[model samples]
Target chain A: MNKSDNNFLGRWLANDLSEKEKKEFENTPEYLAYKDILKGVDKFERPVFDIEANLQKQKEYNQTYLKNVSKGSKVIKLRPWLYAAAAVFLVLIGLRTVFFNTTTINTNFAETKTWTLPDNSIVTLNAKSTIEYNDRSFTNDRSITLDGEAFFDVAKGSQFTVKTKNGAIKVLGTEFNVYSRNTTIEVQCYEGKVSVNNGKNQAILTPGKGVTSIDKSALNSVEIKESEPGWMQQKSTFNQVSLGRLIAELERQYDITIEKGDVDTDRLFSGFFTHTDLNTALKTCFEPMNINYIFKSSKTIELKNR
Target chain B: MPEQQVSVCDESIYDQLYREHAEKICYYLYYKYGDMEKAQDIVQDSFAKLWMNCSKIIFGAAKSFLYKIANNASINEAIHQKTVLKYKSTPQKTYTNESPEFQMEEKEFMDKLNQAISGLKEGQREVFLLNRIEKKTYKEIAEMLGISVKAVEKRMHLALVTLRKKIGKI
Candidate 1:
């Protein structure tokens, strides 16, 4: 066999040769060349576990421990650093407890409530929402179970987890927003790593990254304007967003739906709208796109292509 | 005759699984990622995830689940390391045999095989690894990757062709 035939034979022996090409490399010349190369390939036994005592010790150290400690009335004196260490220990122990002694924080319609988490993290609960967490003590791995929309300013920790109906959000300190309602769940991270896993599907969010999931499947994720988080405070910004998405946000904010023609789905709009009168916010987002909208009623609005 | 049943949710069973398969998983990982530490971490992470979701997983499907998790974890680690290296503005390091001079010939041969394997495109490399290292059937690989059986065969054919050429045999 020639050099090309020799090459084909080598590939066949390596299991890289295709079925159709196998017949071509069956000759003695190609077979001999392949056999020579195969002899040189290193053969190592697969890795096996070492039953060393040290491995067992390491495993024990990493295992989760659930402990509960009640506050005692004695005034025990201790060093400042010792106290900090104790606090950290308490947080770790507290996280091990599956059930939290929670106090519900709720907001009325059109109102918002901001509270500090046990780890000193800040959270702003939007209107008609409630957040529940243990108030007496906080843990090293802080987590909160949520039902509606809340913007979190997560305190830095070793590992933090936020549980919702769809899945759990695990982070290592970051500022973010989570809105889980009905069949839709959304997470927007301002910093650090945030992993969102719903048993089967999973996605990780980085700084300035946001992802939305519907029925446990990731729908779409995009980088938003840095000022987008300020939307809760009425300072909203958009960057190359679809008109449909913009309308949906408006509906969520003002509790009013904007009905538009099918032709306007592809229209893209970019602008900034602050927390202002609903009419002015609507005008700023619509007029530039050459679209006019009319309020059919307090809860509904209609958009027309100009 | 009844087949022996395994429980995916039992921690003891998982511990046994780890004790039994840890080394093989590590070897597979070491071949895929040349880093021993990363291989260990991925194997551990795969087991941890399995432990967390054990209840939802069927016993008979545990092995496949473990393989899937290990595959995903290794991919994620590879991607993460690449990102870290990029952000640090460092040049990519080429792979070489680190075995001592006493084992020079063996090391050289091993390095050649490693180089040839790593040189393949990402898709082809994955297909080859799954088929050869994991010893998975073509049909199983196609199902796991959500591709057609014919596509798997085609990719496998391409991979063998390229590897043979690189080794200078064909």
Candidate 2:
């Protein structure tokens, strides 16, 4: 009689009526008619359908769809500007691959690195040092460009060459140390022979022999009985190395920037400092030289004359 | 429009939706045209269209999209069949392994039911078939037909009343 009753009757025909409503509606004439219609429609059978065959057709359609997707992405034509940008990017990448085949290894802060080259030649790089070389041509050329200090144990094969801005060290197959920094070059031959070249001057060095070239003019060779450099064993050793150079090495090992205030950094320092502890490293470097040092900030250290 | 870009429905979800609705859609199409094989083809094509526009159509809206496409396609097929002007034979009775008397009663009941349904108005028949055969809810039918739920209930009530009157005579 009402809208809700009418909806109830509709739901009854749909079999959507609840149990109570269904029970109440069962006695009504409309419910009986709905039941009769339901019986009639229930006998209407569904045409037999092969669901498996339908799914198979869907699978086949999806296979072609995947093929079209892959083919679609293959030839995405961009705008002319995008094409030009892509072309330029590709050329830059090609240039990097061809000309800049150079691999440069750098150590920062208190970090030390020991790398075995492709030829099995071992090179231990001290803190703040860098060594660059063309690995692709290393087998044939066995050469490396060096900055700062590195101890090398060259593998026996061809001529091993270490080039620096200050000088060049040429050897056959040997264990040696080369320290090259601004205006100062030092080469120490530990196990084998080394030929050092600084401008027109050249010096041949044998075991326990070290050479120092200052400003491309003064060439001094000294005797060192030690088997390997101290820095290689986590200690910094210098035979008459300058305070400025030692401070620079300290900055690299501990990731600090150092500033000198009224301290003569050019003065020579001859001592060994441990690489592990920052406080101990600073004490060993400055105590003997009588230079006072303090932390300016977390990342800075200032050194002043006592 | 901006919201549709975020819900990029991947193919796996699309496949899931396909498996879930394909059977009901096939049945709905078959009920509309009374041709099972032609209905299957239309359902397949409609699902293919859904896949082609999968990225643009959000996953939640996909069911309505599928039905819309199938409905349009079925309409076109009906028009095309009408132009051909070829008379189609009534669906043949399938063989059942029951007794002869039982089969005779079933066939008689089925004939009467078909007659009752064929006598219905097109609107009422469609609403009834979607509700009973395809098993769509009244809400879903209303949504598909762009009518209110009350309209769906009214159509169903009228269709049932007409079927009762027609089949009661037999």
Candidate 3:
């Protein structure tokens, strides 16, 4: 038999070879090797499998665990799949627990609240502000979303990102204050370094450096002279900002309503207002803009152009 | 009288199928994985699995069903371990006149042959061992392995070719 014939050995093993063919094939050294190998292998004995013992074991297994797995119930056949499904469900719930635990802190009107983040960082939220952070994965990835304004004293660790409406600030470990209101985002870095992105422009700030992105114009750089934000010192400072924006900040801080009667609120006013006294606060806020304010009641004010 | 629908749920039919397929399935796993104890455990587990679903299976299909269960059970254990195949040696008559050199050569050749079989590829080894050791027909091996008779034939041919090359090297 020729080696090229793939079926030759198969046919030979099946005893399908003619006697003459077998005789010719047996003359080759290849045939002798296979014959010896087969002879040696056929003497090997397999381990005995005791059917009675195994059957008895299976019967006992069926009695205990199989629940008789037949006409009464199909639980046995369906159990592995159910367990698999249950495992998947538990895995999803586990993932949800780790990823979906969002902790939110909110401050009411005229209320300043200090919150401790999960990573031991501190966030002092200004009045009428909200901060949301993921509590579960805070250690590995430090990030939070802010609305309104807040002062963050970040702990030393990975890059901490403060996401806001108009811009975002990223820093390793630094004290920075972020304020997002209307179309402006202001970032003041008091220590370490920070990278500020206003979607349209990006800037890097060191200690005592600040950037304010108003509308779509270039970022306005300002010097932060205070060791902390002025609001933290019972005072709020504004730089070339509109009067209407000051009115909004005043209302938020004092929990009062203000009415502007025929006053061009777009006029810029640069000044500081104290939080200690309402009369001084309103006078300091509206006097420089040449706008007159009269307290209609304890919680309401009307501003008139002088 | 109702016509008989040969159900494997019947004790007699179950026993009959078990008797027929249990040994073949055990040896099938043994040849595939080279683990006798694991093969025996797999056989027992496959039989238990079969018993659990006995009421839903027909009698004629029980053989293939057992083979399929046995095959599925061995999927995670296809790692071929180097388990030396042991053969039963006939008691030698000490008075025989064969030379000691010839006897030592025979022992060496047998050891090489066993090693060669163990070193064959999983597919070729299984087919070769099942046929050579179990004396199962090519048709039976084809059905058990879920392949065509032609495929089994080609496997046997290639297996023999490989064995020749391996043993001939010495």
Candidate 4:
């Protein structure tokens, strides 16, 4: 074998080499190089998990036992708590539509509804959140005003638009989630091209691109990261996100406050979260650096030095 | 109650498939698209579509089916989200002011790597990324990309050869 082949084989040998390859690579220099690269690369383990919840969900969906049990029942009997959870989930899922159509759409704690727009677009309205569309007719020009959070799967048509208080997003047949509240408008595009315009500033977003808008101005900053929606999917991707910005996102996502005084605000973090619990998310951000958080209420959290 | 045999429809199977593969699919999507939120949203939609076509997909082939859906979703998402290209330096900045020798060495190595990777036929790069980064087994990759496992192995071998040649030590 050539030197390169020998090296490759040697490296393979070091890394739990199968019985067959070990004898051949014992004296290879190429194997040594490969070993070094493997060692270096091994240090950078890509964070991954088995996704137990998803697996369970899949098992439930695919398991013969559950299928048989649920087949005849008109309403698959679930835990009473699950009914509430499902209702909330449905509302959250539907929140995307409400944000797309009306000038001002609002839901109370007990409300969950799906709004089908003029373009046959679907959105799920969430509780205690409001969305409004600026234009009366969405046929000629599609645009809506949003105040809270919404998920959207815009029907592929000529051109669809969603306008928020801080900025307006123009898209052509894309799926995305938009959250515009508290002077920060966040747009995460899952599919299609979305143009986010805040007055004079405009950012055209492709899939896996997001822009954060401040003060109803153009996207002040743009981030490119792995494609994952925040609410529905298990994993959330964060690029080089500032501590303040991350805290704000956490607040919106979990409806909790994260006080900034105790933590170093300058540090930027890049990582992924896969169906991480709220406590886990908080801990992942705080524990490594020895920072601490104090919960003021369900709605408020303050970060302080330990 | 007598046990009733429930025939799982395509929808349930599809839902199951999505639930199974969404995480990895999302991860891949994130890397390809460069946005986590977008990846998640697209993955969910992709799975939803799979659920819509569950009956046509075989249970044994669900993993490949999900990957296909994810690939298509990412491509579609990319095409729809068009932009006027403007140069924005990636935040993962390379040192621009290093010693000339070091910089040149780094540049040369990177150029060689790029040249080697790009020189390979398109199929080779696809296979290499799928195998190396995506960590797909040869069988799964072959089935997904629609080629023989031997062909997949050949491409991978060729890719490694080119990469090693460009790096000069191999």
Candidates 3 and 4, the one with greater lDDT: 3
User: What are the RMSDs of all candidates, in order?
Assistant: 30.3, 20.0, 15.6, 33.4
Best by DockQ: 3
Screening candidate 2 with a backbone cut-off below 3 angstroms (N, C-alpha, C), the clashing residue pairs are: A109-A252, A109-A253, A110-A253
DockQ of every predicted complex: 0.04, 0.14, 0.41, 0.03
Residue A68: error of model 1 in Å?
59
| Ranking of all candidate structures by their TM-score, best first | 2, 3, 1, 4
Strongest candidate by lDDT: 3
For model 4, chain A alone compared with the true chain A gives a TM-score of 0.52
The lowest-lDDT stretch of 10 consecutive residues in candidate 2 chain A is A1-10
User: How many steric clashes between backbone atoms does each model show?
Assistant: 12, 3, 0, 39
On TM-score, the stronger of 1 and 2 is: 2
- Model 1 DockQ, alpha carbons vs. true complex: 0.04
User: lDDT values of the candidates?
Assistant: 0.66, 0.80, 0.83, 0.61
**lDDT by residue for model 4 (A1-306), tens:** 344542343234224356566666556555564444333222222334346555555444445544554585568568899999999998987875564444556755324346777778876554346766544466667766666667788998887777776777888898777777677778888788888887878888888777876677656555555454544554445667666766665665565656787477767777655334777877776676577887788767888877
Local accuracy of candidate 4 as per-residue lDDT tens digits, B70-103: 7777777777552221112123356566678975
> Of 2 and 4, which scores higher on TM-score?
2
Interface RMSD of 1: 9.2
User: On residues A186-226, what C-alpha lDDT tens digit does candidate 3 reach at each position?
Assistant: 99999999999988889999999999888846888999888
Off by over 4 Å in 4: A1-104, A107-115, A124-129, A134-136, A216-228, A234-236, A257-261, A264-267, A272-276, A294-302, B1-170
